[model samples]
Structure formats: structure tokens, C-alpha cells
Target: MKRILVPTDFSEHAEDALKAAAQIAKKNGAEIFLLHLLELPNQMNDAVTNGSSIPEVMLFIKKANEKLQKIKEQPHLQGITISTTVQFEKAFDGILSFNKKNKIDLIVMGSHGSSGIEEILIGSNTEKVVRLSDIPVLVIKKDLDTFNIKNIVFASDFSKEIKKPFLKMIEFAKIFDANLILVMICTPNSFKTTSMGEKTMKNFIADFEVNNYSMHIYNDSNIEKGILNFTNMVGADLIGLCTHGRTGLSHFFNGSISEDLVNHTIKPVITFKI
Candidate 1:
């Protein structure tokens, strides 16, 4: 992990994410790219170049640069290389652009955990990035003095489709030397016998040749609730998930279990695309 990208809106939640990323940067000897995206209106995009809105656009850019400069000079950033960028783009677009341009290894961002109508209406930048990015994204919801990923709860169905991402998840866990607890959520709609669940888990690990992991079958009304409940039960430090990246009416109606987990869970979530 040589480069980490931290996107901010200059909010307290974003600050929390920066602090967490700093801890990881210190440990891995990596540089942190602090980015702030100034989302401009559609009309203002062309206006910034040579039109009446030039002054307003310039003023906004100046203020954003000043904020980024202040953040770069913070005392906690000592001995850690911090690069800042203020761009004119939508939040997720800017993030993905910087990630590709800079070859970012990991992205650390903050979310306030939106759900229900609010989530449906506004959508979340963090969730969007998680859905689209090929790279791993770490979504932080709280401030941590140090990033000690001692225990990780990886919630998955243990199907053949998830095998690829599950391997990537293991590789990331090895970074922190964390113990992995593999859990499969058994909801009423997708109920399975205890014997079948255990058999499935055993075969999945054996076929993949995974080790140093524990397994569990958690029962709940839904997959999201089951994951959260089991994560809390084991006192996990991080949550791991695989996202399907569904879109349009299918996404709107059925929703995504991974996105729901990303929105509702306060714990840090590391998502691998499947």
C-alpha cells in the first residue's frame, strides 16, 4: 500500500476518515492524498472558463485550496507525506479520477450511515465509489486513535460467485494480521439447515484452501441485520463484504445487501467487487 486517497467535504465525518487514514499511512509508510471535490452546477461548468461565473468559481476554488493547505500542515501529519488536491467535479467522479491518475492503493472515506427514504433520494458518494471502483474502499464512520484491525468479520453467502472477491478479502486481512471470522447469514427467506450450512462452509474453505478462519451461521430476518448482529457478537474491528453493483430499477427495488451494510453499519467496511 504505497498511496492512500482520502476524499473530504470538509465535514467532521471526513476529518474522522482522514485521521484514520493517517494511522494506516504511518503504519504502512504510505502517502495520503487529501482530496476535496467542489461540485459545480451544470451551467457553472462552462461559466468558469470564460463567462460571468468566473469570479465565483475562482473564489470557491481559492477557499477550497486554503482549506486543503491548512489540513496538509496539521501537526498530526508530521513524518507522513500528505498531498492535497482541490478539483471541480462530482464527489465520486473526482475520487475515481484521482485514484486512476495517482494509482491509489486504497481509498478511505467517511459516511454518516443514511438509510430508508433519505438513502433512496440522495444516494451516498461512498457507496457509489464502492460500487464502481475496482480498487478496495475503506468506509470509516468514527474516529480512531490508531487503526488496529485485530479482528475482521467477513459476511458472505460462501457461494462460488463470491470466491474471487473472498480471496482478495483474505489478502487485505493479511495486511493487519487480523483474524477472520467467516459468517453466512441465514434469513427466513433463504433458510438452510444447520448441517447444510456447515457443509457448505467446509467445502468453500477446502476448495479455496483458506486457513486461520472461523465460521458461523447467523439467523436473522434479513442478511443486513444478520451481518451486523454477528459482527457485534464477535466484537469485530472491521466488516468485509462483496458488492454486486446492481443498478437502475433492479437496484432501486431489490436494493443491494452490500450497499445496505455500507449505509447502516457504523463499523469500517472493506468491499471487494464480485
Candidate 2:
């Protein structure tokens, strides 16, 4: 990871993410891009639009720069070459544009930036960036400020088809020297044999030299709850997910475990497309 992008709103979650990003950058000799994207308020409405306030926009950007400066000045972040960037637009679009134009290796952003129904972490903006961006996204969930990422629980189905994205997850695990726990949650009413499930997971891990990893299988009625329970149980710092992009009824019913996990778990989640 030679280049890392961390999108911040100067929130606690973003700060935690910065800490994790800094640790990873320090270990791998990478440069940090601390980005603060302005969701330029729409001033089209006669009662609500402040969209054309160039001076106000600049002021916000300046304040964001000062915030990043303060973060860099902290003794914990010494020796790290941290840079800042601020853009005016929709939060998600700003990050996507910046990532592509700058050739960002990875995007680290908070889970919730602005309040909304989806303000589960950095809000819906973080999710959109994750969905739209080609680069991998690391989401630092709000309220996890300590950032002691000793373990990463990778929530996977152990799909038979292996792809290039798996390599990214492997690299991150290797980067942190974090333990990989491959967890599969099964339905309680389902009558599948336990051994069959274990075999699939074992084969998946076998592809990698994951001698340090372990697999856990459970009967879960609720995938989201299972993930939250497992995360807390194991003290996982991050939940790694491989989204297969299932849609329609499957998507609505099973939903996105990664998203649900992000909303429910206090720990951060690192997600990638399969």
C-alpha cells in the first residue's frame, strides 16, 4: 500500500480510522492522504440554499486543513507524511473522483459523516463509495476510538470461485499480522450437515497459507445478529466481508451482511467485491 486515502469529517470514527491507517502506513512505508470532502449544500431552494458561498466553502476547507494539521501534530502521528485534500460536492462523489484521479491504493473513511436514517456509521455516503468505487474501502465505525486492531474476523461464505480481490484481503491481514477468523453462520432450521460446511471453509483457507487462522461455524437465525455477537465475542477489530453482489429478492431478504454488520458492530469493517 504505497498510497492510502482517508476521508474524514473530523469525527471520532474518522480519527480512529486515521490511527489504523497510520499504523498500516507506518508498517508498509506508505504516504497518507487525509481527505475532507464538503457536501456542498444545495442552495437552489429560496429558503435553504447556500450553494454559492465561495467564501464559506473556502472557510470550511481551511478549517478542515487546520483539523488535519492538529491530527498530524499529535505525538502519536510523528514521522508520518500526512497530506490533506478537500473538495466541494456530494461526499461520495468527491471521494470517488479523488480516488480515481489520484490513483488511491485504498480508501479509508468514517462510517457516518452526516446524520440520516443510514447514519449507522459514516452515513450513506460511505456505503455509496463502497458500492461505486473500484478500489477497496476500509470503513472505521463510529465509537471505536481506541483502534486496537489485534484481530480481524473475515465473514465469508468460502465460495468455490476464487477471485483477485481475495489477494487484497490476504495482504491486509498480512500487513497487520492480524489473526483471521473465517466464520460461517448457518440457519437453525436448515438441516445441512455441519461437516459439509466446515469442509467448504477449510478448503477456502487452504488456498492461502493460513496456518494462523481458524474457522467457526454457527447456527444463526439472524446473520446480522450473528456477526455482531461474533465480533464482540472475539474482540475483532475489523470485519472483513466478501460481497458477492446478490440482488433483488435475495438482496432484500439476506440484505448486505457487510452493511448490516457495519451498522450493528462497534468495530470497523473492511469490505471488497468478490
Candidate 3:
């Protein structure tokens, strides 16, 4: 990884993401980009005149910059190369824009999982970014002092289209020298026999010359639950998934398994867009 983009709201959760990103950056000698989004009301959209921002908007930007400086000065981030940016846009849009402009290899962001009415009314920004970003996104939930990845549980259907993302997952695993637990979840709606599942997984991995990985078939009520159950059972440190980035009516009918796992699981999740 060359560059990592972290979108922060300056919450404790955001700090968790920063710490985790710092660990990864230290490992790879990558630069970190800290981004803070300033969303103004529609009436205040015209607050920028010529090149000067209005007083209120400027105040917000200034405070955000100060916070970014404090974050950069944190003990864990001391030796890392850090750059900061404050943008006047929605969180999701600003993150995507910054990543595109900076050629970020990965996006590491924290999310306080949403639920109940809040989730129904307005989904979290992390969910939106993970759904759209072409690059890989790593979602961190809690603070991690070490950010170690000993075992990664990668859940997939072992289909032809998943090969590209599966390869990406393997590359990530190699970074930590982590063992890969390749699982195929069998739900009632899409059930598969153990023999069939094993054969399919074998055929899928046969194309690649991957080592230090094991394959298994898990059964549960749904894909998300199956993945989580298997991850917990194996004590995996990270969860790898491939997102189809479904939207509109398509998403409504066929809910996103990757996004759902990102929200519900406390374990760190890394998603690759297929």
C-alpha cells in the first residue's frame, strides 16, 4: 500500500481508525491522508466568495485543521508521514474525491455500527463509501493497539466473477503472513452439499497457486451470520468480503452482504469491489 485515506469526524471511533491506519502505514512505509468533511446547510453553500470562506465556515475549517494536527502529533502517529485536508462537502463524496485525487491504495475508516430507526432513516457514511469505492476499504470498529492480522476469514461463493477480488484478498493476507480460512456459506435459500461445496472451492483455488490457506463450508441462516459464526469459531482477526456495489432497485431486492457484515461485525472488515 502506497497511500491510505482516513475520513474522520474526530470521534473516538475515528481515532481508532487512525491508530489502525498508522500501524499499517508503519508496516508498509505508506503515507497517511487525514480528511475531515465540513457539511454546510444548503443556504450556506454560497459562503465562499472569490477565494475567501465566510467567517463561520472558516472557523469550522480552522478547528478541523487544529484537530488534525493534534491527531498527527499523537504518539502512535509520530514517525508516519501524514497529510491533512478539510473539504466542504458530504463525508462520502469528500472521501471518494480525495482518494481519486491522491491515488490512495486503501481507505481505512472507523464506523460506529448503525441500527434500528437511525439506520433505516440515514445509513452511515462508511456504508456508502464501501458500496461505491473501487479501491479496497478496511473498516475498523474499535481501538487496536497492535493491529495484527494472524488469521483472515474470507467468505465467498467461489464463483467465476469473484476470482479478481479473491486474488486481491490473498495479496492482503500475504501482508500479514496470515493464514486464510476460505469459507462458503450455505444458507437454506442457496444450499450446497459438503462434497459439492468442497469441489467448488477446490476448483476455484486450483486456478491460483496459493498456500497457507484452508477451505471449509459453513451453514447458517444467512450469509452474514454464516460468515460471522465461522470467523468467531476460528478466531480470525479480519474478515474479507467482495461487494457487488448494488444500488437502486437491485440493492433493495438483493441486499448487500458485504455492507451488512461491515455494520454488524465488531471484527475488522476489508472489502474489495467486484
Candidate 4:
């Protein structure tokens, strides 16, 4: 990979993400783009442009610059070229558009870009970006799994739809040299497929060369529980989910497995966008 993109807002949380991105880029021999989004406070721009309320906008811009400055001056970023950009709009959208126009191979951003009760009410832009971005997103948190990705738990049902995307996942696994735990959860009462059915399924997976892969079928009525049980069993450093664009009620009542995995697993989840 030639370029790595790290989006920031200058918060302590964001700084932590930048640090993780730097180490990953340094190890992978990739250039770094240290980006900051400037959503100017237009509502209060004229109100406090120069008034006694505080130099609100300029103060933020200055802080943003300082964040990038600290990153550039860091000893670890010596050879890695770091570039910065600021855009006046929504944060996630800006980063998404920039990636298409840049050499961005991966994105590293904070999990909770909290701005008060929003953090307690619902997740911030970080969760939204994870749902929308096609690239591999590493959402930083206070856990060793964020930096140490030696073990990967790939949540799959061995579906045929994973054919093309599975190749991409395999590519990542090879690069990271991470162990993949292939968990296939089945309903508790559902009997095993017949010998003939097993033969067909084996033949279906035969070409994937899953010799190193360990598969398990979790017997539980709750699919989410099955996934968590599997994740715990493998002690995953990262959880990989392959999305097929399920939305709305299907996601809610149907127990959107990917979304549930995010909430349940403390380990960083990598949802491979299909």
C-alpha cells in the first residue's frame, strides 16, 4: 500500500488514533496523510468573529494545525511523508471523497468522536463512517487488539456470496499473517446436513484452500450469542464481517449480525464492505 489516511479533529481521542496509524504505516512502508476537517461554526462565526465570546473558530483552527504539527514532528514519523487537509463540511463525507481522489489504502480514525450527550445517546461519526466506507477501517479504542492484530475472527456462514470478497479478506490475512477463525453458527435444533449434503458443502469450499482454517457451528437460537461465543473461543484480535447491504427493519428485527457484533465484541471489528 502506498498511502495511509488518518483523519483527526485534534481531540485526545483523535491523537491516539493518529499514533496507531503512524505505527501501522511505518511497518507497512506507506505514506501518511494526516487530515483534519474544518466544519466552520457558521452559526456562531459572525457572532464571535472578534467579539468577547472567544475566538472560537480561529482557536479551533489553530488547535487543528497544532495536532498535525505534533504528528509531523514525532520521532516515529521521520521517513513517512505526512500531508494534511482541511475541509469545511461533514467529517466522514470529506474523508470518503478524499480517499477516492488520493492514494489512501486504509483509514484509521477514532471510535468515539464524542461531543457530549451524543456519546451517551448514540455513537458518533466514527460508527457512521464504519457503516459507509468501503475501505478497511480500524476504529481505535482502549484495547491491545487495536495495535496487535495477530489473531482475526472471521464471522461467516460459509456463504457462496462471500466468493469475491473472501478473496480480498484472504489477501489481508496473508499480509497481516493473522490467524483466521471461521465460525459457522447453526440453529440448535437444526440437524446436520446429510452425508451427501456435507459432501456438497466440502466440495464447495474445497477450492478455497481452508486447510489452516478452523470451522465451528454454534448451536443457539440467538445468532448474536453464537457470534460472541465464537469470538470468545478464538480470542480474536479483530472481527471481520462481510456486508450485503441489509438495512432498516431487516437490520433491527432480523438482528443485523454485523451491527450486533460491533456492540458485543470488544475487539475491533473489520466489516469488509461488499
How far out, in Å, is residue 46 in model 4?
A: 10
Give model 1's clash tally. Answer: 0
lDDT of each: 0.78, 0.69, 0.80, 0.63
Q: Please give, for residues 1-274, the per-residue lDDT of candidate 3 as tens digits.
A: 7699988899988899998899888888889999989888766676563455678877887898998898888888988999999898888788888888899989998766434212311456776777788889998877788899989998888888888877878878877888999998888878889999999999999999788999999999887778888998999999887777765101211355634544456788888888
What's the residue-level lDDT of 109 in candidate 3?
83
- lDDT by residue (81-162, candidate 2, tens digit) is 8887766666778888888888988888765522331563333676666665676787765554455566888765667543
Winner by TM-score between candidate 4 and candidate 1: 1
Task: For candidate 1, write residues 16-132 as lDDT tens digits.
Answer: 889888888887788999998988877788786555657778889899999999988888888999999888888878999999999998898876644431242146676578778
Best-to-worst ranking by TM-score: 3, 1, 2, 4
- Give the top-scoring candidate (TM-score): 3
The candidate 4 region of ten consecutive residues with least summed lDDT is 245-254
Candidate 3 vs. true structure, TM-score? 0.90
Which residue pairs collide, candidate 1? none
**What's model 3's overall lDDT?**
0.80
Please list the residue runs of candidate 4 whose C-alpha ends up more than 4 Å from where it truly belongs after superposition. Answer: 43-59, 112-123, 143-146, 188-212, 246-255, 258-260
Clashes per candidate (backbone, < 3 Å): 0, 7, 0, 0
RMSD per model, one decimal: 3.4, 4.5, 2.9, 5.0
